[model samples]
Target: MLILECPYCGVAADETELSPGGEAHLVRQGPGSSDQELESYLFGRKNPKGVHFERWRHSYGCGKWFHAARCTMTLEVFATYSAQTPVPPKNVINAIKAKRPDWEGWT
Candidate 1:
């Protein structure tokens, strides 16, 4: 099992307590695209190796959403933080921040 540090909850938590959102949003290198194209680009994913930052929900813990970085090969959790937390390494912070969806208007 992996110990995931939740941004809202703090401390480490069992992997089972969190729901993994595979592969956080990737930046669009090229410009000039419609919403449908952008949505398709942003929503796409690739199960790659090495360190990958992903969104995770602490469903059983804080019940809030957050992010985590882990190794695809070993499943080793290297880092984690909430959406409100300060920036982290590997361009993840900015990536997640840029891709933050408008959840408030969802309902």
Candidate 2:
């Protein structure tokens, strides 16, 4: 039972109230890009076992999409930020590094 804090509505929502929107901050590859770029954009994914960034929509509450930095292994949420952000915030990155010192950085 994952409890996600909704930044918009200030509500702590259960997993059932949210919708997973896949990887966050993906660089979209369109017409001007090469075939490989397009393929990567469409299918390339990070199936990491550790800290990861994701997009989630609060379906049963504010009905807004937001970004979340969490650990895939331990199910620990590092932080949440606006979906409009192109990358996870610096603090979130630092937090992950604190937990996993060996981590190089978020790609």
Model number with the top TM-score: 2
In angstroms, the error of model 1 at 101 is 32
Q: Give me the overall lDDT of model 2.
A: 0.89
Q: Write the per-residue lDDT of candidate 2 for residues 13-107, one digit (tens) a residue.
A: 89999999999999999989999999999999998998788999999999999988888988998888788788888888988888889976888
Stretches > 4 Å off in candidate 2: none
Clash number for each model = 0, 0
- Alpha-carbon lDDT, every model: 0.65, 0.89
Q: Which 10 successive residues of model 1 have the least lDDT summed?
A: 98-107
Candidate 1 ranges with C-alpha deviation above 4 Å: 26-32, 85-107
RMSD of 1: 10.2
TM-score of each: 0.63, 0.94
